[model samples]
Target: MIPVLALIVGVVLGVILDPTVPAAVEPYLPIAVVAALDAVFGGVRAKLDGIFDDKQFVVSFISNVLVAGLIVWLGDQLGVGGQLSTGVVVVLGVRIFGNVAAIRRHLFRA
Candidate 1:
Protein backbone atom coordinates (compact mmCIF):
# COMPACT_ATOMS: atom_id res chain seq x y z
CA MET A 1 0.00 0.00 0.00
CA ILE A 2 2.72 2.46 0.89
CA PRO A 3 4.68 1.69 -2.24
CA VAL A 4 1.59 1.98 -4.36
CA LEU A 5 0.79 5.37 -2.86
CA ALA A 6 4.36 6.49 -3.45
CA LEU A 7 4.16 5.41 -7.07
CA ILE A 8 0.95 7.35 -7.54
CA VAL A 9 2.38 10.42 -5.89
CA GLY A 10 5.53 10.20 -7.95
CA VAL A 11 3.54 9.95 -11.15
CA VAL A 12 1.36 12.90 -10.14
CA LEU A 13 4.42 14.95 -9.35
CA GLY A 14 6.08 14.00 -12.60
CA VAL A 15 2.98 15.01 -14.53
CA ILE A 16 2.70 18.32 -12.72
CA LEU A 17 6.40 19.12 -12.91
CA ASP A 18 6.95 17.91 -16.46
CA PRO A 19 10.55 17.18 -15.73
CA THR A 20 12.87 16.87 -18.68
CA VAL A 21 14.68 13.63 -19.31
CA PRO A 22 18.22 13.72 -20.62
CA ALA A 23 18.27 13.24 -24.36
CA ALA A 24 20.61 10.28 -24.09
CA VAL A 25 18.10 8.43 -21.90
CA GLU A 26 15.02 9.12 -24.01
CA PRO A 27 15.22 5.89 -25.97
CA TYR A 28 15.42 3.68 -22.91
CA LEU A 29 12.51 5.18 -21.00
CA PRO A 30 9.79 3.03 -22.47
CA ILE A 31 11.73 -0.19 -21.85
CA ALA A 32 12.40 0.89 -18.29
CA VAL A 33 8.72 1.60 -17.76
CA VAL A 34 7.74 -1.77 -19.12
CA ALA A 35 10.30 -3.45 -16.90
CA ALA A 36 9.05 -1.57 -13.87
CA LEU A 37 5.50 -2.60 -14.63
CA ASP A 38 6.67 -6.20 -14.91
CA ALA A 39 8.27 -6.01 -11.48
CA VAL A 40 5.20 -4.38 -9.97
CA PHE A 41 2.87 -7.03 -11.27
CA GLY A 42 5.23 -9.76 -10.16
CA GLY A 43 5.30 -8.28 -6.69
CA VAL A 44 1.54 -8.13 -6.59
CA ARG A 45 1.33 -11.74 -7.61
CA ALA A 46 3.77 -12.75 -4.89
CA LYS A 47 1.67 -10.90 -2.33
CA LEU A 48 -1.44 -12.74 -3.44
CA ASP A 49 0.41 -16.02 -3.14
CA GLY A 50 1.55 -15.28 0.44
CA ILE A 51 5.21 -15.04 -0.56
CA PHE A 52 5.84 -11.34 -0.71
CA ASP A 53 9.29 -10.21 0.42
CA ASP A 54 10.27 -6.58 0.65
CA LYS A 55 13.93 -7.19 -0.07
CA GLN A 56 13.11 -9.37 -3.02
CA PHE A 57 10.71 -6.83 -4.41
CA VAL A 58 13.18 -4.00 -4.05
CA VAL A 59 15.95 -5.96 -5.69
CA SER A 60 13.70 -7.12 -8.47
CA PHE A 61 12.49 -3.61 -9.15
CA ILE A 62 15.96 -2.13 -9.32
CA SER A 63 17.44 -4.97 -11.31
CA ASN A 64 14.59 -4.95 -13.80
CA VAL A 65 15.00 -1.28 -14.53
CA LEU A 66 18.76 -1.52 -14.84
CA VAL A 67 18.70 -4.60 -17.00
CA ALA A 68 16.06 -3.25 -19.31
CA GLY A 69 17.97 -0.03 -19.74
CA LEU A 70 21.20 -1.91 -20.36
CA ILE A 71 19.60 -4.07 -23.00
CA VAL A 72 18.32 -1.06 -24.85
CA TRP A 73 21.68 0.64 -24.60
CA LEU A 74 23.48 -2.37 -25.91
CA GLY A 75 21.01 -2.69 -28.72
CA ASP A 76 21.67 0.90 -29.70
CA GLN A 77 25.40 0.32 -29.76
CA LEU A 78 24.97 -2.82 -31.85
CA GLY A 79 22.89 -1.21 -34.57
CA VAL A 80 19.85 -3.31 -33.68
CA GLY A 81 18.18 -0.94 -31.27
CA GLY A 82 14.71 -1.20 -32.69
CA GLN A 83 14.66 -4.96 -32.83
CA LEU A 84 16.03 -5.40 -29.31
CA SER A 85 13.66 -2.86 -27.87
CA THR A 86 10.74 -4.65 -29.42
CA GLY A 87 11.96 -7.97 -28.03
CA VAL A 88 12.39 -6.57 -24.54
CA VAL A 89 8.98 -4.95 -24.56
CA VAL A 90 7.30 -8.08 -25.83
CA VAL A 91 8.92 -10.30 -23.21
CA LEU A 92 8.23 -7.99 -20.31
CA GLY A 93 4.71 -7.23 -21.49
CA VAL A 94 3.91 -10.91 -21.64
CA ARG A 95 5.18 -11.43 -18.09
CA ILE A 96 3.24 -8.43 -16.85
CA PHE A 97 0.02 -9.64 -18.43
CA GLY A 98 0.57 -13.10 -17.03
CA ASN A 99 0.97 -11.65 -13.57
CA VAL A 100 -2.15 -9.56 -14.07
CA ALA A 101 -4.12 -12.59 -15.08
CA ALA A 102 -2.93 -14.42 -11.97
CA ILE A 103 -3.90 -11.46 -9.80
CA ARG A 104 -7.33 -11.31 -11.37
CA ARG A 105 -7.85 -15.00 -10.86
CA HIS A 106 -6.83 -14.75 -7.24
CA LEU A 107 -9.06 -11.78 -6.55
CA PHE A 108 -12.11 -12.80 -8.54
CA ARG A 109 -11.89 -16.59 -8.52
CA ALA A 110 -12.96 -16.53 -12.18
Candidate 2:
Protein backbone atom coordinates (compact mmCIF):
# COMPACT_ATOMS: atom_id res chain seq x y z
CA MET A 1 0.00 0.00 0.00
CA ILE A 2 2.72 2.42 0.94
CA PRO A 3 4.81 1.56 -2.10
CA VAL A 4 1.83 1.95 -4.37
CA LEU A 5 1.18 5.36 -2.90
CA ALA A 6 4.78 6.24 -3.45
CA LEU A 7 4.54 5.26 -7.10
CA ILE A 8 1.53 7.49 -7.58
CA VAL A 9 3.32 10.28 -5.85
CA GLY A 10 6.37 9.71 -8.03
CA VAL A 11 4.43 9.98 -11.26
CA VAL A 12 2.74 13.17 -10.20
CA LEU A 13 6.07 14.54 -9.16
CA GLY A 14 7.71 13.47 -12.41
CA VAL A 15 5.10 15.31 -14.41
CA ILE A 16 5.56 18.40 -12.32
CA LEU A 17 9.33 18.16 -12.71
CA ASP A 18 9.61 19.46 -16.22
CA PRO A 19 13.21 20.27 -16.89
CA THR A 20 12.32 22.95 -19.41
CA VAL A 21 9.93 24.69 -17.08
CA PRO A 22 11.37 27.30 -14.77
CA ALA A 23 10.33 27.11 -11.16
CA ALA A 24 11.97 28.62 -8.12
CA VAL A 25 10.79 25.98 -5.69
CA GLU A 26 9.99 22.73 -7.47
CA PRO A 27 13.56 21.52 -7.51
CA TYR A 28 13.42 20.71 -3.86
CA LEU A 29 10.42 18.46 -4.21
CA PRO A 30 12.28 15.17 -4.53
CA ILE A 31 14.35 15.92 -1.49
CA ALA A 32 11.27 16.44 0.61
CA VAL A 33 9.56 13.30 -0.67
CA VAL A 34 12.63 11.14 -0.21
CA ALA A 35 13.15 12.44 3.29
CA ALA A 36 9.55 11.80 4.16
CA LEU A 37 9.60 8.28 2.77
CA ASP A 38 12.72 7.47 4.67
CA ALA A 39 11.22 8.80 7.86
CA VAL A 40 7.98 6.95 7.37
CA PHE A 41 9.42 3.63 6.22
CA GLY A 42 12.45 3.64 8.45
CA GLY A 43 14.66 0.75 7.19
CA VAL A 44 13.77 -2.28 5.10
CA ARG A 45 16.24 -5.09 4.75
CA ALA A 46 15.28 -8.71 4.57
CA LYS A 47 16.69 -10.53 7.54
CA LEU A 48 15.80 -14.12 8.46
CA ASP A 49 12.38 -14.98 7.01
CA GLY A 50 12.29 -11.56 5.29
CA ILE A 51 12.43 -9.61 8.50
CA PHE A 52 13.38 -5.99 7.79
CA ASP A 53 16.27 -4.03 9.18
CA ASP A 54 16.74 -0.29 9.44
CA LYS A 55 20.45 0.07 9.18
CA GLN A 56 20.79 1.56 5.72
CA PHE A 57 17.38 3.17 5.61
CA VAL A 58 18.11 6.07 7.91
CA VAL A 59 21.56 6.66 6.48
CA SER A 60 20.49 6.50 2.87
CA PHE A 61 17.41 8.63 3.36
CA ILE A 62 19.37 11.54 4.73
CA SER A 63 22.12 11.07 2.22
CA ASN A 64 19.83 10.78 -0.81
CA VAL A 65 18.25 14.18 -0.28
CA LEU A 66 21.45 15.92 0.72
CA VAL A 67 23.54 14.21 -1.89
CA ALA A 68 20.97 14.65 -4.60
CA GLY A 69 20.61 18.31 -3.71
CA LEU A 70 24.33 18.73 -3.54
CA ILE A 71 24.67 17.02 -6.88
CA VAL A 72 22.07 19.32 -8.37
CA TRP A 73 23.75 22.32 -6.79
CA LEU A 74 27.05 21.19 -8.19
CA GLY A 75 25.45 21.05 -11.57
CA ASP A 76 24.11 24.53 -10.97
CA GLN A 77 27.62 25.68 -10.14
CA LEU A 78 28.88 24.00 -13.27
CA GLY A 79 26.04 25.61 -15.19
CA VAL A 80 24.16 22.34 -15.56
CA GLY A 81 21.61 22.08 -12.80
CA GLY A 82 19.18 20.49 -15.16
CA GLN A 83 21.65 17.87 -16.20
CA LEU A 84 22.58 17.18 -12.61
CA SER A 85 18.92 16.75 -11.75
CA THR A 86 18.61 14.26 -14.54
CA GLY A 87 21.45 12.29 -13.07
CA VAL A 88 19.95 12.44 -9.63
CA VAL A 89 16.66 11.32 -11.08
CA VAL A 90 18.45 8.31 -12.44
CA VAL A 91 19.70 7.59 -8.97
CA LEU A 92 16.25 8.02 -7.48
CA GLY A 93 14.97 5.72 -10.15
CA VAL A 94 16.53 2.90 -8.20
CA ARG A 95 14.28 3.65 -5.27
CA ILE A 96 11.31 3.61 -7.56
CA PHE A 97 12.37 0.17 -8.70
CA GLY A 98 12.59 -0.99 -5.13
CA ASN A 99 9.16 0.40 -4.42
CA VAL A 100 7.75 -1.50 -7.35
CA ALA A 101 9.40 -4.65 -6.12
CA ALA A 102 7.93 -4.20 -2.69
CA ILE A 103 4.53 -3.45 -4.09
CA ARG A 104 4.61 -6.49 -6.31
CA ARG A 105 5.74 -8.78 -3.56
CA HIS A 106 3.12 -7.50 -1.19
CA LEU A 107 0.35 -7.75 -3.73
CA PHE A 108 1.43 -11.17 -4.99
CA ARG A 109 2.24 -12.80 -1.70
CA ALA A 110 1.01 -16.37 -1.72
Candidate 3:
Protein backbone atom coordinates (compact mmCIF):
# COMPACT_ATOMS: atom_id res chain seq x y z
CA MET A 1 0.00 0.00 0.00
CA ILE A 2 2.70 2.42 0.99
CA PRO A 3 4.78 1.60 -2.05
CA VAL A 4 1.81 2.10 -4.33
CA LEU A 5 1.03 5.41 -2.69
CA ALA A 6 4.62 6.48 -3.03
CA LEU A 7 4.62 5.55 -6.70
CA ILE A 8 1.47 7.57 -7.25
CA VAL A 9 2.88 10.53 -5.40
CA GLY A 10 6.17 10.35 -7.24
CA VAL A 11 4.40 10.25 -10.61
CA VAL A 12 2.21 13.16 -9.61
CA LEU A 13 5.21 15.16 -8.56
CA GLY A 14 7.00 14.36 -11.81
CA VAL A 15 3.97 15.47 -13.78
CA ILE A 16 3.61 18.63 -11.76
CA LEU A 17 7.28 19.43 -12.10
CA ASP A 18 7.45 18.43 -15.76
CA PRO A 19 11.15 17.83 -15.74
CA THR A 20 12.71 16.71 -19.00
CA VAL A 21 15.26 14.02 -19.53
CA PRO A 22 18.30 14.97 -21.53
CA ALA A 23 18.03 13.94 -25.18
CA ALA A 24 20.99 11.62 -25.00
CA VAL A 25 19.64 9.62 -22.09
CA GLU A 26 16.00 9.67 -23.09
CA PRO A 27 16.16 6.52 -25.19
CA TYR A 28 16.93 4.34 -22.19
CA LEU A 29 14.13 5.69 -20.05
CA PRO A 30 11.39 3.28 -21.15
CA ILE A 31 13.56 0.23 -20.60
CA ALA A 32 14.57 1.46 -17.18
CA VAL A 33 10.97 2.11 -16.20
CA VAL A 34 9.88 -1.33 -17.37
CA ALA A 35 12.76 -2.96 -15.52
CA ALA A 36 11.93 -1.05 -12.36
CA LEU A 37 8.33 -2.17 -12.64
CA ASP A 38 9.43 -5.76 -13.10
CA ALA A 39 11.38 -5.47 -9.86
CA VAL A 40 8.37 -3.99 -8.13
CA PHE A 41 6.03 -6.72 -9.28
CA GLY A 42 8.58 -9.37 -8.35
CA GLY A 43 8.87 -7.87 -4.90
CA VAL A 44 5.14 -7.89 -4.47
CA ARG A 45 4.97 -11.51 -5.55
CA ALA A 46 7.72 -12.38 -3.10
CA LYS A 47 5.83 -10.64 -0.33
CA LEU A 48 2.69 -12.54 -1.16
CA ASP A 49 4.64 -15.78 -1.11
CA GLY A 50 5.97 -15.01 2.41
CA ILE A 51 9.58 -14.74 1.30
CA PHE A 52 9.95 -11.00 1.02
CA ASP A 53 13.38 -9.58 1.88
CA ASP A 54 14.08 -5.87 1.95
CA LYS A 55 17.72 -6.22 1.01
CA GLN A 56 16.89 -8.46 -1.88
CA PHE A 57 14.17 -6.16 -3.10
CA VAL A 58 16.40 -3.10 -3.06
CA VAL A 59 19.22 -4.90 -4.80
CA SER A 60 16.89 -6.31 -7.41
CA PHE A 61 15.33 -2.91 -8.04
CA ILE A 62 18.61 -1.14 -8.55
CA SER A 63 20.21 -3.88 -10.58
CA ASN A 64 17.22 -4.30 -12.87
CA VAL A 65 17.20 -0.63 -13.78
CA LEU A 66 20.95 -0.43 -14.16
CA VAL A 67 21.24 -3.60 -16.19
CA ALA A 68 18.38 -2.64 -18.45
CA GLY A 69 19.97 0.74 -19.04
CA LEU A 70 23.30 -0.89 -19.65
CA ILE A 71 21.81 -3.24 -22.19
CA VAL A 72 20.26 -0.37 -24.07
CA TRP A 73 23.52 1.54 -23.97
CA LEU A 74 25.40 -1.41 -25.32
CA GLY A 75 22.83 -1.92 -28.01
CA ASP A 76 23.12 1.71 -29.04
CA GLN A 77 26.87 1.32 -29.33
CA LEU A 78 26.25 -1.70 -31.55
CA GLY A 79 23.65 0.18 -33.61
CA VAL A 80 20.75 -2.00 -32.46
CA GLY A 81 19.37 0.17 -29.73
CA GLY A 82 15.74 0.07 -30.73
CA GLN A 83 15.69 -3.66 -31.17
CA LEU A 84 17.29 -4.28 -27.81
CA SER A 85 14.95 -1.88 -26.10
CA THR A 86 11.94 -3.62 -27.56
CA GLY A 87 13.31 -7.00 -26.57
CA VAL A 88 13.88 -5.83 -23.03
CA VAL A 89 10.40 -4.39 -22.81
CA VAL A 90 8.82 -7.58 -24.12
CA VAL A 91 10.69 -9.82 -21.70
CA LEU A 92 9.97 -7.60 -18.72
CA GLY A 93 6.36 -7.19 -19.75
CA VAL A 94 5.90 -10.95 -19.78
CA ARG A 95 7.47 -11.27 -16.36
CA ILE A 96 5.29 -8.49 -15.01
CA PHE A 97 2.19 -10.09 -16.40
CA GLY A 98 3.12 -13.42 -14.84
CA ASN A 99 3.68 -11.76 -11.52
CA VAL A 100 0.34 -10.01 -11.71
CA ALA A 101 -1.39 -13.25 -12.50
CA ALA A 102 0.23 -14.87 -9.50
CA ILE A 103 -0.74 -11.99 -7.30
CA ARG A 104 -4.32 -12.12 -8.49
CA ARG A 105 -4.50 -15.83 -7.86
CA HIS A 106 -3.08 -15.39 -4.40
CA LEU A 107 -5.44 -12.60 -3.48
CA PHE A 108 -8.59 -13.94 -5.06
CA ARG A 109 -7.97 -17.66 -4.70
CA ALA A 110 -8.49 -18.04 -8.41
Clashing residue pairs in candidate 3 are none
Error of 1 at 27 (Å): 0.5
TM-scores of all candidate predictions against the true structure: 0.96, 0.54, 0.94
Residue 86 of model 3 has an lDDT of 93
Candidate 3 per-residue C-alpha lDDT over 22-102 given as tens digits, one digit per residue, 9 for 90 to 100: 998799888999999999999999999999999999999999999999999999999999999999999999999999999
Which portions of model 3 show Cα errors greater than 4 Å?
A: none
Runs of candidate 1 with Cα error greater than 4 angstroms are none
Q: Which ten residues in a row have the lowest lDDT in candidate 3?
A: 24-33
Candidate 1 lDDT over 16-107, as tens digits, reads 99989999899999899999999999999999999999999999999999999999899999999999999999999899989999999999
C-alpha lDDT (0 to 100) for residue 85 of candidate 1? 96
After the best TM-score superposition of candidate 3, give how far the Cα of residue 13 lies from its true spot, in angstroms: 0.6
Q: Report the C-alpha displacement of residue 21, candidate 3, in angstroms.
A: 1.4
Candidate 2 structure, TM-score to reference: 0.54
